[model samples]
Target chain A: MSINRNENSKLDFLLEIGNIGSGNALTSLAEFIDRRVDMKAPRLEFVDFNELFGSVGGVENVVSGFLINVHGDVNGIMLFLLQNELASEVCDILLGSKLIDLNALDELHVSLFKEIANIMAGSYISALAEMTGLKITTSVPDLAIDMAGAILSVPLIHFENVFGQILLIQNSFSVDLKEYNSSIFFFLEDESIAKLMKQFGIE
Target chain B: MGKKILIVDDAAFMRMMIKNGLTQNGFTDIFEAGDGQQALDMYQAERPDLVFMDITMPNVDGIQALKNIKAFDPAAKVVMCSAMGQEAMVVEAIESGALDFIVKPFKIDRVLQTVSKVLG
Candidate 1:
């Protein structure tokens, strides 16, 4: 299947997939916490490299991030990020205890966050696979709690010469009257995006 | 003593969850491996009656481990437990000799039923 390579069409197709992926993530998280997870409409945008760090509250914002490589029929990078305050609250709920410090996360806390990343990203990829009839697998997630710029730079630096804009989804969801924000970034080259669109018979 | 079972996943929390679930239900003999390589070694060392394997890991993956264990012991009973529940993975695991596939965020009852059915 040959993709038409129309830029707007490609962005539209990606936006559609982003909606599905974020929806799947929200549903999965709700089931994980066994709570009502309500999400605002996800914003899918293509941001230039200079604006990328600012999208997540500047380069120095301390946040928890997880990166997982997606492979098989379609290849890309999946990133999930949460601010430190939200991360701490989430840890409290997930770990079933109040955490005194977000700076020092025990191994168990890290493992839980990694699992959450796995589950959320896996849910998105699973939905994509089911919809496109493609085989998609994810790597075990690598996590970090650092400045947003530092975390975002990993992919940016890797694909600096290859990609001009990064595809990002800003997802906001509330649970039990507390609002939490997260962002999922997909770093795929033009060729990969074309390959993904081709599966949907988008011409 | 119940039949010995092995749980393979990189996440310690996940291993603990499954372990707690099984122990609460009277399945006392449970073993754990952090990755596929460890799973292979533990499988050989413990000769666990059933294995719950995760698909993605660092050193080795569940699919490769499942293949290795099947090669070592054709009678091996393995079930895939992972968050990646795509059709392709499920089919691949089954083709590679997995007896069953259990998607993550699963219910304890479902895990118990798979264990009972496979071990019985």
Candidate 2:
């Protein structure tokens, strides 16, 4: 079941929405560091859950991820993933603090990283809400500092009963003379997708 | 407490972020609550001069908590700590009783500015 084949215009619509979200997220991130963050055009796609691992190098890559379940007008899971070391660097840049070892994380380190994810995810959804005029509320964010595949598996599996297709937005961000990449995966339930399409009047 | 500031959020980290910014900027008496219910209780107990709260949380959200505090103390100084996309809720908070609203991933300068403006 190819989402593009059935809903070409819908994919385009979501791509634009994703672009707005990615742009907004980068802008907020830039503010966090009090510097300009460069962003590339966001790439949106629909792929199988298992293939997600292959999209970001391999399933075994150690990464930091934030999972949020969206409720209200539409229901879905949103995942924010970035490489582990880069996640720590993001903390360093955003907090104006440095870590002795990038791989190691203390309680505060994890908290800071999770807070960053929270803001990014919040900004992403905020753009969607504004554009579609939907009442969207996000749940408490769950952070996983582990293999990318393992962390994403939880939400991907949770949506298995309801959805097979996953929509991902890859956003490239560069700040403070360094570049880091992150992806936001939006797995909407079948009904949720219908609600979103109806809101935009997409057939 | 002298010019106490109350920060509310489910994420301990977010509270820490706000507290860090305020403390660095010379806010001595700072209080924190994990949710809206606790924020209401703390507001009643502490009667802090300013309240900074997140719009979303587990037990009680920022909006309901703001309303509760405003009803309890009509002159309570409340500032909503909202995430970017919560424009609607921010508006509702302002309409209810919030002095102003600040978006998250907040800079210390912006946070301080909001606090000062609210104080004035």
Candidate 3:
């Protein structure tokens, strides 16, 4: 099953999986909201660490995220982030109710948010695993309801010592026939990339 | 008590979510475990009518736990919770005698449907 891959070819392969994953995510989200969900083509980018904060509002912007650890033939962290309002909107639809203001994240909010991220990422990676013909698996997600910078900082450890740009998929999701747009992000390491290719005898 | 159910996952939050979903559907006779080791022990202690087991975990994972439980009690009704829709893994679980599987980010109705079909 090995296919020869240059750096560009490798990323192309991964991005293909990203496309499938994002499509799965959008479908799952559409089902959850019981509304139409649309997504623009996911963009692959390499952003500087310091400037990464600006892509999603900023480091100080309040956000909610789901953190998943990829295991097996490939190993890295996959993250899904959404703006605060959209996250709450999703929760409202999922629970079939709206809640009043809350400056703090309570147990219930975190739980619902985690499940949303769980299904989204679970479907994403599951599709990726199927596409790659590798034994890729994911652990239970860890959630963060905090400032964007704070959330990104924790996973930064997984990226430590690696210089240059951080690679990611920037996906835009439009939910429920509304023009309101949201986002989901993913991060996989170069080592994982190599491992995945190696499994298919692509050394 | 109603039909006893056991949920096995590494995350307390997920365990709570599934439990809440089950309770909302009037299936509240439930027990929880953090990982496969605890799940196996609880399976013996609780002898739940059916089990919902997550595939990935810190300690003894779901596959090993499923094997252990099936080995211990051949009649154990076990269903796997798979994060990825991996064909090989699904095949392995089925080979290990899993009754069925449900993917994560579950809809409550889907969960209940799986439960009822398995219980029947």
* Candidate 2 Cα errors over 4 Å, as ranges: A1-4, A94-97, A100-104
Query: Quick one: best DockQ, which candidate?
Result: 1
Worst 10 residues of 3 chain A by lDDT: A1-10
Candidate 2 local Cα displacement, residue A62, angstroms: 0.5
RMSD of every candidate to native, in Å, equals 2.8, 2.4, 4.3
What's the C-alpha lDDT at position A14 in model 2? 69
Lowest summed lDDT window (length 10), candidate 3 chain B: B9-18
| Fraction of native contacts, model 3 | 0.49
Model 1, span A1-203: residue lDDT tens: 22345577888888888999989987888877677888999988877777787888777878889999988878788889976666666667767786667677788888888888898999999998888888989999999988888999898878778775567899988888888889998877677777778888985
- What CAPRI-style quality would you assign to candidate 3? acceptable
Return the candidate ranking by DockQ, descending. Answer: 1, 2, 3
Give one digit per residue, the lDDT tens place, for model 3 in A1-203.
Answer: 22334555665666676677778977776765577777788776545566567776666877777788877877777777777778767767756556455456566666567666767777777787776687777776787777877888876765655533355667776776555444455566677777766655555
B1-120 per-residue lDDT for model 3 (tens digits)? 389999997756578768998988788789998789999899999899999998877679899999999999999999998566578789889999999988665667877888989887
**For model 1 chain B, the run of ten residues with the poorest summed lDDT:** B103-112
Per-residue alpha-carbon lDDT of candidate 2 for residues A1-203, written as tens digits (9 for 90 to 100): 35646678777876787788888887877776567788888878887866777777677877788888888887888888876656667666655577656456676777677667777778888888887788787876788877877887887566777876788888776776678888888887878777777888886
Candidate 3 segments exceeding 4 Å error: A1-6, A48-51, A96-103, A162-165, A179-185, A195-203, B9-28, B57-60, B105-109
Clash pairs of candidate 1?
A: none
Alpha-carbon error at B49 in model 1, in Å?
1.2
